[model samples]
Target: MKTLLLALLLLPIAAIGDDSRQLVKLPPAAQESLRQEMLDNLVAVNEVLTLMAEGKVKEAGEAAETKLGMAAMGKHRGKPVDARPGPHMPPAMHGIGMDGHRAVSEFAAVAKTGDRDKALALLPNLTSACVGCHFSYRTR
Candidate 1:
């Protein structure tokens, strides 16, 4: 029974290893779209970091919210943008839908009043949701 249980657990691990070995095959257009999405998201996130560092927290929060919303909708150039696998994936971009919505809402509350400190304080929590999502899901 113990051996059977151990085998059952190891079976999924072996399957996952095999899956990882399989090359990720995407069409050229899809690959380009994925690359662009990653670049755009990185730019947006970097901008937010800059704003925060400059103590322009309100602006940062607003920009973050806007970028996050765009990411969540997955609409780039009138087409859908999907998440990319591996390091190309931005943690923040992975959190779409409800998670993104909540983060934006929180950021907005602090941003509306142009409160730099408050906005800065909210940034980590917002970023954390993104991190959580990325850790939980795998992109194709």
Candidate 2:
């Protein structure tokens, strides 16, 4: 009964649709590709955190660079050529994407130094790009 009431209350808002964010229109293939990349990024970040927790900071750094850093750029990760989404993104959005890659690269450098605390401190700088991009735009 309470769930039904909650759904009824939220229905109006759902009908309104969330329009505050900028929509990034892409072809269906590109959409799927970008979505997969984003999911991979999340996993990469998780591995970074988990490795750090396990006291393998250098390994974590390596994983971050390999999976999320600048070296990871231009890798459509087996997506079809038509599914490459970067060129379709708005300039600002593309810039944010690059910033995210650069952030992980910077983090990788610090993490490679084996100074766990310092590397961990830099994580927010790395993730802020992701947060900003997600908040600013939506592919849907």
Candidate 3:
């Protein structure tokens, strides 16, 4: 009885772990578009990181703002391509969309006020969202 109870308890944890793993099933065109968007964001984020490391906070903030804006607009194709119904859309993609919007909004607020310190502080959250998205959904 104890062993069975323990197995039952662990089963939910295992299921939750599986739930967090994303398996994206994007069409070829959608895959290409997402790849391009990731590349663009990577470049922009890299530039901002470089600038920030050099203590060019203002320039970094500006670049960050641009990157964030691009993310917000989903500039690759201006929106998520319509995926076929069912498990076509991964959980990570949904997480990315939500987190990306939050990160971008935070960066925008800091950029508008020219708050370099705040912007710099907020950079990690933005980068986290990007990294999180990439880890889950990348074209093979």
Cα distance off (Å), candidate 1, residue 102: 3.0
> Rank by TM-score, descending?
2, 3, 1
Per-residue C-alpha lDDT of model 3 across residues 22-111, encoded as one tens digit per residue: 356678766666667668778987887787688776776667667665344645434444532213455545545555656666675675
Tens-place lDDT per residue, model 2, 103-140, is: 78989999999999999888775576676676667888
The regions of model 1 sitting more than 4 angstroms off are 1-32, 70-74, 80-97
TM-score between candidate 1 and the true structure: 0.56
What are the Cα lDDT values of the candidates? Answer: 0.55, 0.79, 0.59
Ranking by lDDT: 2, 3, 1
TM-score of each candidate structure, all chains considered together: 0.56, 0.82, 0.63
Model 3 residue runs over 4 Å out of place are 1-20, 70-72, 76-88, 135-140
Model 3 C-alpha RMSD vs. true structure (Å) is 8.8
List of clashing residue pairs for candidate 1:
none
With a 3 Å backbone cut-off (N, CA, C), the pairs that clash in candidate 3 are: none
Q: Which residue runs does candidate 2 get wrong by more than 4 Å?
A: 1-18, 77-81
Task: For candidate 3, give the lDDT.
Answer: 0.59
